[model samples]
Target: MSITLYALDGCPFCVKVHDALEANEIEYETVWTEAMHSDRNEVKRVSGQRGVPVLVDEDRGVTMAESEKILEYIDQTLAQ
Candidate 1:
């Protein structure tokens, strides 16, 4: 199972999720949100939304938005 995060550099929620991932020892790669329409298309393709800090959990077959939900999912799945 692998985890990927879609986020923006200046987003507070993105930073929160990143911090949680690090603290919980979750190995995840971040894909930045759009600098252009094309960059954003990937996020839309994956999650169907423009929200940053989306978490895609390949192991559980979940793609989610919102920082809190992402954090909660991470805590439940990997924080142990």
Candidate 2:
């Protein structure tokens, strides 16, 4: 399973999602949104919104936004 996260530094929601992933011991690759101005294009293309803390779980075919919902979904999926 490949999990990728689009996030920016100093974003509280991003930090929340990251902490949840860490607590679950889930490994993921981060695409830093603050890296450059042009880098946000990828996030916009993937999610249709210019937001941080977007996550793509390739194996599950899930692309998610929002920290609370993403955390709940991950916990439920992991439980199952």
Candidate 3:
């Protein structure tokens, strides 16, 4: 399974999501929107918003917006 997190470095919501992932020991690839121009558009296209902390799971073909919701979903989905 390939897990990707699209986020901007300075976003507090993104930081919270990151912290949640780390606390739960979830392995994921991070795509920084500020650093990667293409990722910004991709995130916007996928989530219909330019906000940070979008989570994408390629294996499951799932993309989610909202940091708090994403964290909860991740925790529930990967908790096994």
TM-score of each: 0.89, 0.87, 0.83
Off by over 4 Å in 1: 35-39
The local lDDT score (0 to 100) that residue 51 gets in candidate 3 is 74
Candidate 1: pairs in clash: none
Order the candidates by TM-score, highest first — what do you get?
A: 1, 2, 3
Ranking by lDDT: 1, 2, 3
User: What is the Cα-based lDDT of residue 46 in candidate 2?
Assistant: 87
Pairs clashing within candidate 3: none
- Candidate 2: count of backbone clashes, pairs at least 3 residues apart or interchain: 0
- Candidate 3 residues lying further than 4 Å off, grouped into runs, are 35-39
Top TM-score model = 1
When superposed on Cα atoms, how far off is each prediction in RMSD? 1.6, 2.2, 2.7
Candidate 1, residue 22: lDDT: 94
lDDT of 3 by residue, 1-80 (tens): 68899888888999998988888888899987865555478788877877778998888888998987997887889654
Which ten-residue region of model 2 has the weakest summed lDDT?
71-80
Steric clashes per prediction:
0, 0, 0
